[model samples]
Target: MFTPILAISASLNDSQRIHALKVGANDFINKPFIEAELAARIKNMLLTQQLYQQIAMQKEALEKMAMTDQLTGLYNRHFLMPYVEKALSSAQRYNYPLSIVMIDLDKFKLINDDLGHDAGDKLLCGIAHILENNCRSEDAAIRLGGDEFLVVLPHCSLEQAKFKTETLRQAITELPPASHKTSASFGLSSTEEGNFIFEQLFSMADSAAYQAKMNGGNDICH
Candidate 1:
C-alpha cells in the first residue's frame, strides 16, 4: 500500500517541520491551516502516490521482459541461475527430488533453410507450447537460446522426469502438419542421482541430449 503521511501541528516551528519531513512526513500543515489548502495538498499527495505506483509497475514489467524469451515467451537463460539456485535450496532443505531436462530441436537449421526462418519460429513456438502443457505448475520451462530449451521439475524422481520427457518428445513428433514434422532430443538428470549441483545436473542432461541426437533425433536419453 502506498501511504502518504501529512503532519499537522498547531505549534510546529520551522525546525519541527523539517524534522517531520525527515522522519517520513510527506507534507506538514502548520497552525490555522486553511481547509482549501489542506484539501489541495491531499489531492497532490494522492496524485504523487499514483505516479509512484505506476513507476513501480513499469519497473516490474521491464524486469519480467528481461527474464523472458521474446520469441517463445518462455524464461530465458538470464533467469536460469537464480531460479535453479532457489529451487535447489528448497529441494535440499525439504529432501525432495529435483530434475532437469534439456531439449534440442532436431534439424532446426534444415527447417530454416528449407522453409524459412518464419517456419522455424513457428515450430519452435509449437514445441514451447508442448513443454508448457506437459509441465506442472511448479515446473519451469526455459528457452536456453536458439533451439535449446530446459525444464526444471521439482519433487520429481529420475524415472518420472524421463517419462515426462518422452511425452514431450512424442507430442512434438505429433504436431500439426503446419509444424513440418519437427522433433526434438531430450536429456534428463535428477538429484536422486546424488548430484545437487546445478551445473553438474545441467551438464549431465546436456550430454544425454547430445547422445539422443547422435542416435538420431526424436529420442530421449539419460
Candidate 2:
C-alpha cells in the first residue's frame, strides 16, 4: 500500500488530491515537494498503506484473468458486457444510437483438426488485430473465446456498425487463410429506442451473425 507521493502537478487542485485518495494514494503535498519531505510522507504511509503495490499488482493480475482471454490478449465475454451496457446508457442519455457487432471465425475447427492448434492460435491473434484496428476510440473489442469476438460501439448507428463490421470482414478475408480456408460472420444490433434490453439485444444480432455464417463466410448481416 506504500506509495511515494510526489505531487504530480504544482497546480493540482483539491479535487486532484481527492482523486488520488480514491485511488488509494496517501499523503498529498503541494508541488515543489522537497525530496526529504516526500520520503518522510512515503515512510509514514508505508505501514498504513500496507505496501499496496503488491496488492495492486495482484489485483490487476486477477482482473486480467477475469477479464481477458488466457490464450489471446483480447478481452473475455464477461468484460464485454459492461462496456456494452455503459455505451448503451451513454447513447440513451444523450439520445444517440449504440450498436454491437459480433464476429465468429468460420470453419475454425477444421484448422485445428487439420493444421493443429498452434496455427489456429496465430489466426486468432491475427483476427484480434484486424478487429482492433477497425474500431474507433469509442469502440471496444473482446474475444469471447473459442473463435468468437464481439465489439461494442458507442454513439454509433446500425449503418456505422455495419460499416465497421464490413471493414473487419474485409481485413480478415485478406489475411492469408491457414491450410484450410478461414472466414468470419458478423451480426449487428443497435438501440433504436433509448433503453436497450440486455439479453435479447445481443440475441438478435448473434442470430444474424449465425445466419451470415450459414449462408457463407466473410459477410456481415445487420
Candidate 3:
C-alpha cells in the first residue's frame, strides 16, 4: 500500500506533468537535468511524503480516541448505533439470529456511595475487561454509560447468548473483593423474524434486564 515511487522521465508537457503528479509520482525529472537539482527534488519529495504519513497516522489515532471509551478502552455508546444498525440489517436480510445482551452492575450505586467514585470506576473497568475477554473478536463489547454495558453478538441465538451471559456473570463474581462486592444482572434478546427493528431489539433486551434486576441483583432474563 505504501509504495515509494519516484518516476524519472524525459521532458513532459504541462498537462502530462500535472497528470504524473496526480497519479502519485513522487518526483519527475526531465532529461539533461542538473545532478544537484534532481537530488534536491528527491529529498524534498521524501520529506513531504514523511510529513503526509505522519499527519495520516495522527488523524487515525484521533478518530480511534473519539470512538473509544476513555475509562474502559471499549467502544462507547456513540459508536454502537451505527454498527448495530448495519449488523442488524445484515442479519435480518440473511435470516440469521442476532442477539443483544444488556448488562448492569448490581448495587453499583451503593459501591459509589460507600467507598468512593474511584472504587466504583475501577469495578466498572474490571467488568469491562471481563466482557472484552469473554466475547469473540467479531462481537462488539460496548460501555453504555455508567454501570451498563451491551454486547452485540452477530449470528448468535438466544440460547448461545444465555450461555455467554452466564459465563460473564460467573467471571464477575470471581473478581477479587474491592471496596464492595460486585455482581451483574443480564438481559438477553434475539431477533427471530426478519422485520424486527433495532429499537425493538433494544427494547426486548432492556426489558429483560429490568426484570432481572427486579427478581434479584445477580441473574439473567430473556
Question: Which one wins on TM-score?
Answer: 1
Number of backbone clashes in candidate 3: 0
For model 1, which pairs clash?
none
lDDT of 3 at 77: 74
Ranking by lDDT: 1, 3, 2
lDDT of 2 by residue, 1-222 (tens): 344453456877888888887876656787788889877876776755565777888998998799888777778887877776777677777888888888888888988888889888989988988877777777788887788888888778888887777778877876655446678999888887544876777897899899988888777887
Model 3, C-alpha of 118: deviation from truth (Å): 1.4
* Candidate 1 C-alpha lDDT tens digits along 26-133: 998986989999999999999999999999999999999999999999999899999999999999989999999999998889889988888888888888888888
Name the better of 2 and 3 by TM-score: 3
lDDT of each: 0.91, 0.79, 0.86
Q: Could you tell me the C-alpha RMSD of candidate 1 in Å?
A: 1.4
**Which regions of candidate 2 deviate over 4 angstroms?**
1-50, 193-195
In candidate 1, stretches whose alpha carbon ends up further than 4 angstroms from where it belongs are: 177-179
Looking at model 1, residue 209 earns an lDDT score of 95
TM-score: model 1 vs. ground truth: 0.96
RMSD of candidate 2 to the truth, in angstroms, is 8.0
> Model 1, residue 146: what's the lDDT?
92
What TM-score does structure 2 among the candidates reach? 0.76
TM-score of 3: 0.90
Per-model clash counts, in order, read: 0, 4, 0
